[model samples]
Target: MIYIACGAILLALGLIWLIKPAKKANPLYGYSSYLAQVNQGSFAFAQKKASLYFALFGLLQLLLGVGIHLLKWDRYFLIWLLTFYFFILFPIVATEKSLKQFLIKRHELPADYVDPDKVKHEKTKGFRDRK
Candidate 1:
């Protein structure tokens, strides 16, 4: 019963995102990745990618959850947790990786863009180098 409920909630959230993904980066709302926050364009792209992948994976999770409950596999709680973890992580990682590749391919990322995650104090040039 609880498993089914959780699955339903996940499905609902995914549907909501599919209907209307967050447009901008906000601490309270959209996907707040540093790569996504680079600019409005990146923000929009990241949000769309994240929401799309999330909805897809979320649906998978819902089905898996239901299957678990139906099979009376309550002892496999760890499997459920692992599935949920991947469900949450897949979209975020995919979005960031996609955004990074897009920026690099287009050569649009700012020269001074400091990747705090990659480096400690290395300096960069600027933000959103349109050129």
Candidate 2:
């Protein structure tokens, strides 16, 4: 029963692989929003914040999931956390490598989202703009 539950959890998380990055055509901004102050060219700042939250949440979920499986902790909670991580953090981490490869192969990639050049300054500037 435990293994079956674990498998179900994994499957749920796997399904999230479909909706990884939460970005849409454009995210609506609001004063109460975490992105309330976000402006144009703030990709890195925004990306960093989003990535940090995603990673933090992802790690927590992964830890909880692994804990459930390995440490025999809260099974249901872990499973749900794992599912959430799979969709959320997995996509953010994927903004770099394996995710890119998978997306490229599966034709689920975003348009005009090219890899940045080695120019860290330019990249930083672009991501730091307050537009």
Candidate 3:
């Protein structure tokens, strides 16, 4: 029962993140990690990737919970508890690793390389319009 509830909550959150991710790097919402918060590109990529991973993991958790319940695995509560924790934490780790790979790829660009997205964003707002 607990696993089902937790899985549902995770799935809901993941869906929300996917539907409307935070546009800016704010501490209050979205996948705000040091690497993710480094730039708008990383932040956006992290949010999208994290949402997918989370949703996938959440669905897996829900199925696992159902299986455990059907098989009467209540006797091995500790094992199930650890599995729950793994499902919760594994997505974050996977997202971070993928984010690192993304950053590394971006860094491979030439020194004079300019991100068109950043340029467009800057052009839309004045210097004092910083958020």
Candidate 4:
């Protein structure tokens, strides 16, 4: 019963994530890490990529929970509980690692490559413009 409830909640959250992924890399809503916050490109990419992984893993969690219940696996409750948490954690870790690798590769690329989404700073001609 607990597993079923947990699965349902995960499924619902996954669907919500798939439908409306976080648009920005704010600390509150989306995945937050130094690599992810490197630029808008990384931020958006991390959110979308992470959300996709999250949704798929969440579905797997739902199935695993249901399978445990149907198979009468209550004797190994602790194992199943730990597995459930691992399912939740794996995606987050994988996404962060993936993003880190991507950022490293991006940095290795040519200097001519520019992130279009990066905010442009205007030059101030006078002190008043700086205000």
Candidate 5:
């Protein structure tokens, strides 16, 4: 019951983040690691990547919960407790590791490097014209 509730909450939050990620590096919401908050590009990339990981983990957790319930493994409270903790912490660790790798790769590019996709997006949306 607890596992199912936690899983559902995580899945819902993941979907929400996926559908409407934070547009900027504000401390109020979204993935706010130092590397992710370093720049708009990093924040966007982290949000997308984090959402995918979260969604995937949440689904896994939901399935595990269902399996445990069906298998009558809930009696082993300690094991399930550890498993729950793992599921809770692993996603954040994985997201941060990926974000670090992304920032490293981005830094490897030339100082004047411009992301073509970002340029195309801005051009299409006219983001540069706004105040």
Candidate 6:
């Protein structure tokens, strides 16, 4: 039970740590720098890559957290708290962080942008659930 909780903490941190967003010199920088050069007009490529990883990482973290709770390892009250924290607080944090980053990058785009294939321009309003 405790092992699961510990694993949740470690997994969450591990996924977050997987993102390399710094300017530190390393092998990854060579590839990312090349990507930046290819996308010299904007930071879209870098941000897109980062956002993809963010979503994937968050999904994995959420899944692992849910799996832990489903095992019913409620041997102590502390486990319940940790479970609640991971299922509730952790998701909120992850979603909020992801949304903030998405918005930030999106807002930086050209104001004249348009996607003709998008349904947003249609009269139909899509359902959106609030987090």
Top candidate by TM-score: 3
lDDT of 3 by residue, 1-131 (tens): 65776787778878999999988877887888877876788889999998988888888888878887999987788877766888889889889888877988888323454543467544445457765
lDDT of 1: 0.70
- Report the Cα lDDT for candidate 6: 0.45
* Regions more than 4 Å wrong, model 6: 1-42, 74-131
lDDT (0-100) at residue 74 of candidate 5?
83
- Per-candidate clashes, comma-separated: 2, 2, 0, 0, 0, 0
Cα shift from native, residue 103, model 4 (Å): 1.3
Winner on TM-score (1 vs 3): 3
lDDT value for candidate 5? 0.77
lDDT (Cα, 0-100) at 117 in candidate 1: 72
Model 1 misses residue 24 by how many Å? 2.6
Off by over 4 Å in 4: 1-3, 108-131
Per-candidate TM-score against the hidden true structure:
0.70, 0.31, 0.77, 0.70, 0.76, 0.29
- Candidate 6 at residue 86, lDDT? 49
For TM-score, candidate 3 versus 6, the one ahead is 3
lDDT of 5 by residue, 28-83 (tens): 76777766777888889889988888888888888889998999988887877766
Better of 1 and 5 by lDDT: 5
lDDT of 4 by residue, 1-131 (tens): 55566666656666776678777766666667666777888887787777777777777777877787789987888777666677767777888777866877788333454443576889987766665
Better of 3 and 4 by lDDT: 3
List residue ranges in candidate 3 displaced over 4 A: 108-131
Each model's C-alpha lDDT?
Answer: 0.70, 0.43, 0.80, 0.71, 0.77, 0.45
TM-score of 1: 0.70
- How close to the true structure is residue 87 of candidate 6, measured as C-alpha lDDT? 38
Considering only N, C-alpha and C atoms within 3 Å, which residue pairs clash in candidate 2? 39-131, 40-131
Error of 5 at 103 (Å): 1.1
The order of the candidates by lDDT, greatest first, is 3, 5, 4, 1, 6, 2
Candidate 3 yields a Cα-based lDDT of 0.80
